[model samples]
Target: MAGNDVEAEKPAHSLFDNLQGLAFGVIMVSFGISLLKAQGLITGQAAGVAFLISYSGGIEFGLVFFVVNLPFYVLAALRIGWGFTLRSLACVASISVLTSLAPRLFSYAHVEPFSGAVVAGLCVGIGSIGLFRHGASGGGVGILAYYIQQRTGFRAGWLQLLLDAVIFTAAAFVLPGWGVLVSMVGALALNLLVAVNHRGDWYIAR
Candidate 1:
């Protein structure tokens, strides 16, 4: 009876709650991505790949980000659920649109690379937590990381850090040595923030 009462106190989120939460998450992430673009920096995970392609090909980051995430939806559906997959799809699409519109919305005159990286990391980390709490994600590596954590008791942030290391190394070929190092700082900040805060026990809302 006590367990039931405890569970009852933590009710699931309503549709409106989820919509707002997801919208907030998308806005935060898109802002972070815009910061990175402004600084000519790359992040980790699937977004990193998209950034690389956009930088090299002179293409739009939003289009590349959206396209790169397509394959991951299949994995998300198979491993998670259709509901989760759909929510994630919506999140990814919103980010794409927001990021595409970011340039016109605001422009940065000057932002130090290191400071910008740290701020961008914090933005993405907090935004991602919101998405996860609402039972959605940014798709791609986020889906994989969440699945691994749920299945193996591993930390999703740590797994992403490992994957980010690989992406950072590859970044050396595309970015200058100094740029790669600075990018690493951002990735570390983002992943560490997620690792420290994204605990299942800490948040009860589903």
Candidate 2:
């Protein structure tokens, strides 16, 4: 490629933006774990899979979760382009690192089922909205959601709901009923948060 062409194609992202996203990812993972432990609720997709492995195999949930998600990062890069992918990788890595390390750093883990669901929903909803605001994503459902958006221009949030349904359904069969129900409540909260917060036309950059 020509030098000028390559230079023009480069993606730009500020350090402040990256750090902000990293902070969001960390808090989300930390709270997510708290919610799960509190309600005995499982998460979706790779997280749900990780919960199963950790619950059954006596492995660290973060370790299992990271390993399961590792294989998909490359595909995420290819589809979403490098800058967004890198930011997402940072978010994913932060989530993994914190999930593994947070328990050692903090003491609270117990939570009531209803409260756990509320916190999990809020954490994911707010975190995801922040990521979207910065023109990046954590690259799980976001990756699939983008593809569907490109093809259909439909609401990616709805796509996520459908996808989460499938994952949570499988989780229900594997996990206890109350846990599954809590996850459902968490899902509802996450979708509502995204819908309410992500109106691009309404947002003004600070």
Candidate 3:
């Protein structure tokens, strides 16, 4: 490996930097999720599950997402450590707050579903890179997936794909067929960005 790469892997981000990363990343994700929700679309993993529950019960997305993540914190604390667990909690809390406030804070004058999907994917995907680099996660399936991957070399990609399939299948029943299909496009975009950028061998100033 290059010296720069090795160095990049070693330096830790400052507290301010991590806080900035968590704040910005969570905001981006919250915006993306808000757009998806407005369109009756769903992504993958825990967020997707939260969306399903929220839609079915007419509950706020923030509340549903927060409640759904309760169990995952145990896994995060046990597997990742207190620092990671705390940071992840902060990220999730930011998401819950930002998502709850986004709709009220801004109005979407023109929201094309397909465009919303693309935007959501790009924003969340790119933002997630920042969050992960700062040693924080958006909680839910991400924490569980990492914990499982640590125990077994089963790869997070496969696990995410399976979860996406399950989420989409569930969406097919509750959401419009078109909404479910379009949601897949956004999910693909998001995952593709993550796959391309979030490499362990890449820059890792965590």
Candidate 4:
């Protein structure tokens, strides 16, 4: 009877968690897109390059997002287990599709740059935690960071910082120089929140 109760509860709990992840993922993607529209900031990643291309060429950001992530899905499968990779892929799909559609429905104009940066970072960070709890992520630099952590001992956060540095450095030419700094600050906030909160031994989630 106890085992039966546990089994029944498990699926319910999983459904709840997935719904929560989906909700947060929507907010995170929306926040990111809003930041881009408001700040003209390019995030440091393949996504950043995609944003730059989209901004300059008038391409849809979501299509650019999906294209940029295609190659990394293979790397994710090779490094992480298939299940983790698939879940991450799902997250990427949700984010990309919603990112594309949400902007069409909503206006993100008139947000102050500094306020938007901080709020956007917090939204992305909290949303990332929600996705990570469900075995998923936003899946850009995070994918590369995961692969690096698998092959080398460097922490995923550190690798992410390095990658962001290079990517944002290149971004100087693509955006106003100061926008690069704001984007870097946003990345720092997001990455810091992830590094601090996501410890394997801290939470006994089953």
Candidate of highest TM-score:
1
List the global CA lDDT of all models: 0.89, 0.68, 0.81, 0.70
Segments in model 2 whose C-alpha atoms lie over 4 Å from true places: 1-13, 150-152, 204-206
| Residue 90, candidate 3: alpha-carbon lDDT | 83
Q: What is the TM-score of each candidate against the true structure?
A: 0.95, 0.80, 0.90, 0.81
Query: Mind giving the per-residue lDDT tens digits that candidate 3 earns over 94-144?
Result: 899988998888777778888889899788777776777777778588777
List the candidate 4 regions with Cα displacement exceeding 4 Å: 1-13, 147-154
54-171: candidate 4 lDDT, tens digit per residue: 8778998878877888888887777777876877777777777877776667776587776677677767767766665666657667777755654674566666667778877777
Clashing pairs in 1: none
Q: List the pairs of residues colliding in candidate 2.
A: none
lDDT of candidate 1 vs native?
Answer: 0.89
**RMSD for each of the candidates:** 1.6, 5.4, 2.7, 4.8
- Window of ten residues with lowest summed lDDT in model 1: 3-12
What's the candidate order when arranged by decreasing TM-score?
A: 1, 3, 4, 2
- Clashes counted in candidate 4 amount to 0
Please identify which of the two predictions, 3 or 4, would achieve the higher lDDT against the true structure: 3
Q: lDDT per residue, candidate 2, 1-206, as tens digits?
A: 59567556556657786577668755775667655644557765456667777776788876777677766667667776787677666776677777777667766556667777778777867777677667555546665665555457666667777777888767766778877887888877776666666664455452
- Ten residues in a row with the worst lDDT in model 4? 197-206
Query: Which ten contiguous residues of candidate 2 have the minimum total lDDT?
Result: 197-206
Task: Supply every candidate's count of residue pairs whose N, Cα or C atoms clash at under 3 angstroms.
Answer: 0, 0, 0, 0
